[model samples]
Target: MENLHNDIYPAIDPSVTKSLHQPGKVVLITGAGRGLGRSIAEQYAYACVASIIICARTSTELDEVEASINKINSAVKVTKFQLDVTSETAVKQCFEAVKEKEGRLDVLVNNAGASLEWVSIDESEPGKWWNVMEVNLKGPYLLLQAFLPLLVETARSNNTVVDVVNISSIAALLTFPQSSAYQLSKAALLRLTEFVDVEYKDKGVNAVGLHPGGVVTKLSENNDAIRPYLIDTPALCGGFTVWLTKGARTWLGGRYAAVTWNVDKLLSMEEEIVKGDKLKVKLVV
Candidate 1:
């Protein structure tokens, strides 16, 4: 029998998936092959997103995710691209493919990561830091650069906005001596989020760093020592991310946030979760 790494019990709520109903909106997700990415993709597919572009390094893995979505709703359009997000050429090609297939792109979820390994900084080698930076920071930056045109076009042509949600970590803000490289990259990712917000705010493109508080996944399951402290699940993170994109235009952007905190804002009625497919907007008029 294969080893079953059960870091979290499944408590998936499909109701959280109702945010992606823009009729013809297009979404592209990195690292959609497994873990939280798979969960996020499942929820988006369930919401009847117009088009979902799933990318990962393994063609077989991408195919698996695509096939799984097809099983749930065969009419939902899912395009798979074999990609290593760290490569600028690959990122450019993937964005081009999205432009070709979808004509306009509406959302991007930067979920690809490289800092899955857990080891004391003292025990880690030099290449570890480089690998983490390459995937976590460089990849997302390249994706944003390559896709900015499509995002701008989407906003202008369709009367819809573009969202870039960067999946960061609490480790970025809190000290985690075990993985310094991961910490540094995620912190920089938050900065990148700020830059995106500043540069694109006037253009109607919203970007933010979302810290999915300790979601159980392959990285967390592989490390037995730190798994106990994590409280959130992939499904919860996925659900929150989809909703975040739906309403991030009104919510403050360019800062780090978590589901636990944002959901509390909803519960306390500081922010109202809008009904139907429209984004929640604060009344200023």
Candidate 2:
């Protein structure tokens, strides 16, 4: 899909009532300490979500985001977890904590990821390459396992839909040199998204794989090859996420989206996209 806007416009900004204001939802985000993760959390705060749970490896980063959330919306309850998303026990414990306290979870943003040195399979450190898969692929799976019950229950109780946004990448669809571990992990995530939607859509759960635009984050900054392409604002992905989740966007379930794509344009193309199964991973793609 062609991108109509590269940055935040009036239509998708978190302050846009028609597009972004969805109050009282409970959201949990992994990697919420910094970069696109923090951006997504902040946008949810702007939407006046009832509570937000943020998890990251660094306690200091979590503290900063909590303070930022407080400034954005003091009424918004903020929970912090110093977590490794790849740890099954930790993820399950986080799940228990949220289930006990919130009793519901409306959205899960699987944003925690790892990217080692950009080296080819032949040159890559075996341990480091495997770590990317652990964080990128297995991490989301752990989260889904831990949280899907509460998400499904939340939907059942509300008679509405909940969401799982797997933060995949453009690399999932395209190819590049020296990106096998990262790229392949993200690619598999799209299939995982599809599987989740098929299994749970009738039960009121939707999952989507997303590319969070090219932003100059701490992560992206380390990749010299993509420096010139990191032209997008951090707010673009943040606001796009708020827009995507405002309502039951089951139409977009089990597909892919890029924050750089104009959301209104995507909505307009919905019928065509659904009919042709566009934006999905397949043999042609």
lDDT of 1 by residue, 1-285 (tens): 112112222222344334444456688889899987887787777667778889889788888899888886676799998899899999988887788878888888898887747667777787876889989999899999999888988887766667888888776776665777888898888889888978987777888687776766776776676778676667667766666666445444666666545453443443443232122111346
TM-scores for all candidates? 0.84, 0.97
Best candidate, TM-score? 2
lDDT of candidates 1 onward, in order: 0.74, 0.90
* Candidate 1 stretches greater than 4 Å from native: 1-20, 116-122, 262-285
How does candidate 2 fare on TM-score?
0.97
Which stretches of model 2 miss by more than 4 angstroms?
1-3
Q: Model 1 clash pairs?
A: none
lDDT against true structure, model 1 = 0.74
lDDT of 2 by residue, 118-207 (tens): 898899999999999999999999999989989999999999999999999998987898999999999999899999999999989989
